[model samples]
Target: MAATPHPAHRFLTMKAAGVTLAALVIILFAGLRFVHLEADFPPGVSGSGDLYTDEGAYSSAAVRWVTTGQWRLEGDFNPAVNLPVYPLIQAVTFKALGLSLGHARLTSVILYLLLMAAVWALARRWAGPVTALIALLVMAVNFNAFAFSRLALLEVPMTLFVVLGLLAAARGGATGTVLAAAAFLLALLTKTAAGFALPVILLVLLWRPEPLTRRLAQAGLFCALTGLGLLAYYFVLVRGHLPDYQTYFMTNVLLRTQGGLWDLGRALVRIIWYGRQFDPVLYPLALLGAAGVLVVGGKLRRHPLFWISVVWIAAYLATLATQNYAPARFYLVLAAPVGLLLGLMIEHLARSGRRGAAGLLAGVVILALAVSGGRAVDYLRHPQYSWASMMRELHGLVRQDGRENPVILGHFANSLSLGTGLLSLNDHYTWKSSLPARLERYRPDYYVTLGGIEAPIRSVLERYGTVEPVRTWDVFHNYYTGEPVALYRLTRKSPLEASRP
Candidate 1:
């Protein structure tokens, strides 16, 4: 018979197991994100075409900055649409890697890796190594988190800074407080959605057991430093466009307060549905963890990290539910805490000697990985979802028609611009009212429409020029459903062209 292990030896063995688990989580994250990055695309397709439309805009702006030395969108210096820090980082990536979609997306992947590391540190500090490992696993396999890691969006990086801020604030000292403030500032500048972290940060600072006067002073100092940083950012980057910035802020804020009771409830349901889609098993696990946190309030009430997690989730939900619209990516802020909460729940199960329950929890982690990882693989393999071939065809047509770096207008403008190596004037989803005025101002040689145009916009295009049918591409949503989006090239009349001149 094998000798029974010493108590100290058992503890060391457990420690080794925990460390191995953490390393496996990191490996899973890296593999799921990096593997098949180049899969499911047409041969020689431009990397920029892999991005979602808004993602294309961000990448395009970075590409423009690389070529034109302006960080904003070419011809539009508005900071309202594109923040500086993300674009600057993307520009640096393009500078180093020569401007491919893969290169730009690598920046997001790197940010996500750092984000995972920061989340691990925070979870390890608040909970323990096992909880930290669980937290990392939950986040690594979440579909929404996994999806964002592959795009060059602001949410992942913003969440990174917010987690760093929370981790720093948990340390409770003058230096920690200062670092927390700096991280918070970076989060805000990265994306305004991070403002939700502010109330939670202040609350954590207040809960510190220092003298009331000292606590107030520290909290005030943190807020002051954050405000000063914002002021500096505003003066340097957004001063000339301050009104635009205010409008953007007010529009988003007003949206939060616009809807009625039913709307709010519907929004709440949608958030739950989104969470389910992202991680069906872990979403419920996090909810159970949250309930566990409340049930064991006596032990947790004095813990600042506990309050921070609760407040963080509450603030994000409150803000998100109030919004007129919330995309799934907006919930990236909630993922880290949800992951932490799930970790806490699993730890609770272990402490209570529920080995079977803990084993079930481990099974749920594998389910999350299988569902989300499979989806990621499918998404990467099907280039039809991205329309890369369509963009390539459009670029070919533009070259064959003898247009020399001509400007293209309309909704598919970014892809057309990137694919053809030409200038494109597009505003993603908006700018409908300004379409005619934009056409009059820019006099783009080609106006392309993809995914069909509204009757009114079609009328305007017909009035301005000739509508010639271009190739139609079938975009597949899943194995069962597919739809054809016809591309049309609208050539401006010489008379209309002269009118602009």
Candidate 2:
């Protein structure tokens, strides 16, 4: 009964709707991450185990930088290790926000929000409005990704840099190349594991439909800049600490290489187990999407997004399987790729005039929201174990003098030092031949025996002195996943100088 609307009017209406929908998606994603943002944060030094005082170590440096105005990695309450960019960010945040674990975690929560937008923007370019929204929703609904965003950890920042770098590199210009190169360099600086995805950035450049010389030029420039940045970082941070760096390599890298062909099988099983992070619905859909891409991706097969996803999944999964393994938080980087792959399938379905595409997408979103909602509720009810209060209490127990805060010596001693502002040292990674001497040299007023691990420390404590923990607390990597870590306090050390070799 009404005249047909003008074509421009229809286009305007659709554009407005798309923008509004995107706004809602981003708002929802950010809101979820911010809720209970400080849940069990600063999880205390070694709160997550394996010297997992990751949050403490980083926060301590930032606090020192801001309070003492010295970037002292060797001074009291300092760990011998260092990471520059992330701690610097923390210092800035603490400088402004008055320095609490909550303020520090704010950085990750913000980065988490930016990461969602970046994923959506990247997908919008690769697929379209519908596929972009689909990808963002899928990523947002991931509970592991959601859960980890509440920590003051480097992984979220590294992953954000990776996605942003790829997005910039895909834009196809000299400016984009430079921005992408910088972002990639920042990722590497955040953690060396980021090197696993370096080749993907180069692929983005070389795969461009441009003259070979131009592509080569851009790729060469990107490599040169990134390499220079890494060198400068090393020159500044590691050149003075060569021995410590070597120890880090031996423990972090060589120890990881201890297995053989049999490990590949174990790695497969481990990765499958880790895939539970994607949950009952999203992961299976991703597998289906991955298979679907090969059969029906059409133009997507030639797209950089497809190749990037393939390369990242292969490289990260391979490395995760082989060496440098840790908790499933390592899988956070894959969230975007997995979502994009699923979006690819949805895009193909929609293009084929399948109206169920809308229904299918809605189903995925609703299911993801429902599942993530359950996780959120569970998280709030029973928070993760925090060792912060316990560490402070133990330090207080044996401190006979207030003029000097008692030193804490054990695994992740840096964290104890940082979190509690007490002198702390642990030769946790030093060659075993020198361990006894290393243990005797510190003469810590107190010693902490970690769970089932740190036999060397326990042996030294036994051989030398009266070791006791006033009390023990139950803790895990996250919400009780692994064995409980034991906390011991060395209440008395009898003539450690006599026990030394």
Candidate 1 lDDT over 101-209, as tens digits, reads 5666678888998998898888777677767776777677666677667766778888998988887776767887899999998888778778889988888777777
lDDT score of residue 170 within candidate 1: 67
Best by lDDT: 1
Q: Root-mean-square deviation of each candidate, in angstroms?
A: 4.5, 4.7
Instruction: List TM-scores for all candidates, in order.
Output: 0.85, 0.81
Give a tens-digit lDDT track for model 2, residues 1-501. Answer: 999999879967975786586557556656866666544532322223533556665466676666556655342333334346787787788788865556777887888778887888777776777667666766665676666777778888888888888887887679988988899988876776788778888888888889999989999988888888878878987788766566666766678863778877688667756665545577666766666666875766776667777787767776677773656567777778777776666666666667487457656755776677566666666765355555565556556445344666655665554445565555454566665565456556665545553666567676656676545555444433354435555544446555577
Best by TM-score: 1
Q: How many clashes show up per model?
A: 0, 0
